[model samples]
Target: MSGIEPVEHMARISGGIVNWRKLLLIAAVTLVSILYIPDAEQLWSAWLRQEEFSHGPLMFLVALYLLWRRRVLLDYPDRRGTILGVGAILLAVFVYALSIKAGIQNTRHLGFLLLIFGLFLTFGGVTYARFVFPSLILLPFVVPPPSFLNSNLSYGLQLFSSDLSVSWLRWVGVTVFQDGNIIDLGTLRLQVAEACSGLRYLYPMVGLGVLTAMLFDIPLWKRGLFVGIAAGVAIIMNSVRIFLTGLFVEITDMGISEGFFHLFEGWVFFLFSFVVTLGLCWITLKRSERKSLGRGVMSVPEPTGREPAPMALVPVTVALILCILFLPLATYLRHLEPSIPARASFNSFPLKINGMIAEEDLLPGVEQEILQLSDYFLGHYRTGEGPPITLFAGYYEQQSAGKTPHSPRVCIPSGGWKIEDLQTISLPRGDTTVPINRVLIGKGDQKLLVYYWFQQRGTFIANEYMAKFNLLWGGLTSSRTDGALIRLSLPLRSEQEIPEAEKRLAGFTQEVFRILPAYVPD
Candidate 1:
């Protein structure tokens, strides 16, 4: 009985010892994580204000939560020694530094991955890195696909959705005509633009699904089913929203479909989608047994009732040093890049209007008033007229830069007014051609300048790879002011060109304004 009592006492002593080392390591990690987290916070705030898609802190929180739940797994015997763990941490630091220097997209994304890797090395070692490699699959979701890929995909989606909706409406005995992203449904027209592609919700919906499947320990097949279901729900909800918007436009004379429908209905659909997702998650949990498993089995021998090793204190101290050093390091690095130029401004004249304007006032004897209205809306206004009218000339010019053909042109067909016209013009640059579009409004004396320019041959949009890389290079590889100029030419009738032109411009714009209502009444 005395020998057994000694063993029991030892077990009791082991159980009573505090895991101070782990606690210190955790404290250190939390402090460093705080430093790394601020960048994501700004990004998240910006994302909330935007109508476009951007997944912010959601991924970070999920990763942290999962890691916390798997804490016991870290106690398992690591095949590699602590030296290997330290080496892994160093390598991750190098990767993070390189990614930062390169100004890579989703810098936070790479940082988070390296963070997870570093912690594993600093604590869990080689076997943990191997086991957690599945997290790499989530990386692609973080760095959004290249802009070219997204743009093409979005454009295709817009075209497809427009055609599909138009065809469906026509089949249902409604008069419908397909035109690019717009669908004409007799009394009202519907646009299935890029935003209507359900892209804004894609990342979150898919992300939540993935997290749910992993959390609940659902079978891979069921996980896929859940994701597919979520995607279907997103698509169906988007279509219903669009349909209702179109119906509202048809039923009401107020044009509520354009603005109010977009603003409120988006929130409504998002809410509905969220509820559907939660319901699915509940159903998943009902079928799950090991889904809520707390943690992995611990392999470490229990501690005796002795003080923890000084190694516990080391992590906390190092973490504090890092936190203290990080801000200065980041600020110095920021100075290495040149400041981005401020955005240009456009001057506007004061004018007032009461109702929608007639197209004939601007077109001057256009046979098809509806078609003329389309042209007017699509046309750009200049102080004086010579070149044809362009609506989105700036967009076209940006797109046309750099191509095999000496001159590139894009023609847009307006089905509402039934006229097709070339909208973009490409002009030759050094080795590449710059695309330009001219928009003209008001006959004879009034003309407006709208120009788009790109300095780099291959890069067109702000989000392009070359563009982002060029931004990092501080306009060294690419010109900083490498953009096109928008010019408006107004012909002067008198010797006082500037004053006379300003007066005529003021009067012309004011007249134009009076013709068109400033706000749509609903």
Candidate 2:
């Protein structure tokens, strides 16, 4: 071979090497950061258990594919800023440590976001422009909104859904009585609880939007519009499902609004959203030039076999190795024992909620349970059954703690006739007005009461702290004493009730206390 020909061949080989490095860099960064996603465990569990919510890992794979498909775009010549990316990594480490100290639930998610955003800004160079969709797409999944915000949103959605459903019912000429998140239709009353709020659809649909966005190359404004439309479509469709379920119940003597309807409504809404999104995308495509909309025939570049830059490989390898090291650590962190303070700090005297148990005899075949109330919370018993009743288990503390500056004093005019209002409570004795809120409103006679001190210290943010409290509260409430302060009338009761309940509650509280030590008087 000629000497000139030999040099040309070497140049091509060097270019191929450069291209490979870039791809590897992108892959390594993504792989490491992916572990930190907010619902990583749930995602993995879904995949493992073959559950309905198993589309999580597919999202990462799609992002990876998007990056690969735009290899040329990523290979663009541009300035690289390693320092900024390093700073992001450093910042993430700092936040992660702080999260551990503060007991933040999704610390890894925060870290992952910082890392991805930082890497794209710094290391990704000009390639960042091509990959913005993937970043946005992955963000919602990675950084789950804090539980406090999520609960508030869910609560709000419940209200919104109820209103929407009520409006539709009236439109169909049905008389409806609305109370909070519940709607009463002569024969049927629908409570728009967490299951009906369409939250289950939000995360997955957002993901679908991201995937759809990546597949289509449209102007930013149009893309935003499409995404908004898709989300709106999901929500609206869910509202309609809520309305239709009510209608179905009213129309059919069969209880279609209850069990299977709940399960079927989810799928129906999902399908409706999918169809609407596709329809919108098609309309948008038809309205714009095919090429401009990125829906036209695309050109395929020649396989240059260009390798990636050597300098990029070092960092990519380092990142992958570091991520491999941290994966186990992240898992360990998630399972770490709750600090002792959060665990043992249930002794905020004056008012305390003691326990709860299901009383089948009180209202046979329906859920009948009572929650012990303390003056700690100026409160009301939330209507529900089982652990961490609300999505925002954290918020109850602030509502219950008597620490908020301007919280309302909730009182039940009549104590539902089950148990007479005891003027004085002797357990954990203290001189404080026990403000209680109890209600009986279910097929079977069901009653719950919440009593707490009505006072406030400052602005409060409920979070994992509330979850810890819930763990203890749930355990204690389920326990029944042979002759405890509250002997729940049971059809068939067991002797191992109070001690077992206390033991379980203690264990759960201990788990939380590992993260948060009980507030001992410092």
Candidate 3:
């Protein structure tokens, strides 16, 4: 009877430990889901809509598998959470709240990662955190790059690929003339559009490279090299694909550049690039050690029967408490509508300003829909002589992700205009100088000088980062996110005409800036 009693006592203790651990884990997951489900839904929608982020679901599954594989690390002796973990949790919650208010999806995604990292560190300590780092790091790849970044990268890649394709075609005795991203194959003209810019291949291949590096028992430098090789392979293969398309068009027909065949060719080349990159990485490994590629990668000895350490409870509880405290605040901010101040409409803007004869222009309905602006002004003003000065201002009563003003720096390149020189210059305005971005852009023989700035409340911002910071700050303090992008452009016929164009733009800017307060509001 005494022997049976001791055995029963031990069984009860083990059962208690198991139940407590299970409860803690369940609570942690529930809180995280409650906080981040909206973000997760946004990511899921992006994965479904965007080809570039199509690898998100697969990466997520792989991260889970990795975490499961490294589960034994959590049971290591003396495992305890740290103060740094607590700080991380606090920082994550704050960032998440701020990003929510600012309507920035990329930062929200980052906040999600920080939350996961903080939770793991708080519950499992440094050893376990290190073991699971690879899994957690895979999350950033799931979200597509912000639209502005994606646009700039796509435009640069298009021009580069077009130039390479043109050079390759000419080398092969096929006459081709290149203009920006356009490949003139004499009889057939092919434009290297955004779809063929190779971002679809680059992003996924880089993610795969990281995954491959994590799985392989390789040196850190070698892992970096492998990722670089993957990026290079993707870019080179995309260029080659363009070259092939041009060749086929010259020799065969235009059908090779469109429909099913074009897509099939891209898939085939991407696969080939992957194989080649992997082969290169394998060859770079020492012959004697190549057989043991994944031998010790994230492998740890299985832990024997273990109980949750009491020390871990402090950080875990603190993290949960912080999250719980933050949840209500986050919810309130998410639902808080920004104060949209009443203002004069852009339609009331005058046609003539500063003695320049003006003609009003309306953006196409498609463009208006894409921009999502509350109000806008597009005016072409001309003096008695010289080229006209074009003025545009787009106003948003409330800015959110995907519904913000597009920067001309990005928009110009997309329209096939290469920015020759760009700098921030001060325009003298009354007592103090107002900072503005000046850009010299060219497409073929046409050149234009542009001046643009962001007007937020009463502040004139020249930098995009500063503008975003102000947006976040304003949303928090004043509950106001109203802003407008004001731009002025003048054409230059010759290099000598640059001075005159700049002078014209500066004069026109003063007149527009004076009346902008009425339409855009202070």
Q: What is the C-alpha lDDT of each candidate?
A: 0.45, 0.46, 0.79
lDDT of 2 by residue, 147-194 (tens): 545555565666677788889999999888776566788787777766
Task: Point to the candidate with the largest lDDT.
Answer: 3
Model 1 per-residue lDDT at 126: 50
Q: Least accurate stretch of 10 residues (summed lDDT) in model 3? A: 73-82
Alpha-carbon error at 51 in model 2, in Å? Answer: 8.8
Model 1 bad stretches (over 4 Å): 1-24, 27-31, 51-68, 77-105, 126-157, 193-195, 219-225, 247-268, 271-328, 337-522
The TM-score of predicted model 2 comes to 0.59
lDDT of 1 by residue, 1-522 (tens): 988997875454344322443454466567556656755564566457544445545655656555554444444424343455555455555545544554443554566566555554444345455445445444445445434355555555555555555555556565666555676667766667556766666555666556555554446687677677666666655665665566566567546677756674566667678678768656655434444432222122333443222232343344345545654665554456533333222112122222222221233353232111111222344322432222221211112112101111111222121112224455443466544443322223433333332223334332234444543453334223223212223433433454554454344333432322221000
TM-score of 3: 0.90
Cα error of candidate 3 at position 435, Å: 0.5
Q: How much is the lDDT of residue 429 in candidate 2?
A: 19
Q: Please report how far candidate 1 places residue 162 from its true position, in Å.
A: 2.8
